[model samples]
Target: MGVDLRRWWFDRQRLRGDLLWGVAGIVLVLAATLGGTLALTALFPGLAPVGEVGADPSPTVAADAASGLAVNLLLGWFFGFAIAAFQEETLFRGFLQNLLQERYGRLVAIVGQAGVFALAHFGYYPVSAWPLLLVVFLVGIVTGWLVDRRGTLLPAGIAHGFVG
Candidate 1:
């Protein structure tokens, strides 16, 4: 399975034109998400209060940041690009969402996956951070829609990486 997966992954025909569109889609979606977040934060500042129980950065995260700029960038690239974008998107969007869509239709699959994606972060965020959950859900929807539009997971993965 691993060998087959690698072969398919590196197949030039399968990957043609994905890089350009994927990067472009990611940039567009990221800009929209950031703009929306800023607007929401401005309108409802209470939703994003700083130094609150769930708002403070974790010690482990702070330590990672303190590990110096190069280390931080490397770690970010590894996790954001390799893990979150490629692996997670392949699993969630490529396999799970695609399977669900075949059985249940597009809307159900998108919303269902988004719900799962939002819930998957429950351990990392407190219930008080509902705003973040909402954003994550919205991002999931955007990524899922991108997958459907592009007829491939590359664009979705790119957008997901940017969101991460």
Candidate 2:
């Protein structure tokens, strides 16, 4: 089946459920990312991430940090919350995962979508930064599960905005 735009929209009737799940998703993502990184650091003391998270500033924001910080921060916040949030959830969970689910099954869909989600971060982290990728993969798995459980992208999108 093709992507159902209706399914991708937030169900106002389930706003409470979506918000609750979104909070849970946030906690899960943080736990996965932080815990995984800590565990890896313990195992490999010398492990170093290729780039620090939130280090790369957008071109417009970077152009003039002296004054753009405030404005760019607001813009960035909106961009993350409004655009990236919905876009990513719709793509990864609403579309890709459902596609995989139809052909492979729920478990495979969650895992397969998670694989793609982690790989999508290649732009930020190189192959050498496997630890971060591992953490991201775990985050993907949890978020994918959240979407599956909730049957909506709102929760994951909210979590993504917070985590982004």
Candidate 3:
């Protein structure tokens, strides 16, 4: 949540207290992925494999994200961080990472996990599918880079939460 975004977003957030910078990173990455994919694959090419399916956003997922944020924020210093920080950082940043890195080289492992994060977008909408996956994949790379540079997961999770 605290580092490595393009200067436009970062500079403004810096004035506000570095929180928005977290958000900026996510936005920037998503934009990058979408821009890149649209440039290379066109908009509808991935529709068959991913877009032609799915409709509703799961109530369970919505509930989890909402309740998760509520619980974590209220219980701050513990659960707030545990939910907002720990779950994403350890699970997305560490667990999925371990599995991926073991089976593939570090860069590929990171890219694969990013793809999985992107794939989760299928739960949203068909037309939104490719862009969502592309965004998340890019996000994964930035987060992994943050983790590597900071040697901590909390910051990355902060960015993820704010972006969502």
Ranking by lDDT: 2, 1, 3
Worst 10 contiguous positions by lDDT, candidate 1: 1-10
Across 11-89, the per-residue lDDT of candidate 1 in tens digits comes to 3675756667677777767875677678778777777443576446545665556677678677886688788888777
* Candidate 1 lDDT for residue 105: 100
Descending-TM-score candidate ranking: 2, 1, 3
**lDDT scores for all predictions?**
0.71, 0.82, 0.58
Instruction: Score candidate 3 by lDDT.
Output: 0.58
Off by over 4 Å in 3: 1-86, 127-129
Global Cα RMSD, each model? 4.5, 4.3, 10.1
- Flag clash pairs in model 3: 72-80, 118-133
Q: How far does residue 97 in candidate 1 sit from its true spot (Å)?
A: 1.0
Better of 1 and 2 by lDDT: 2
Which has the greatest lDDT? 2
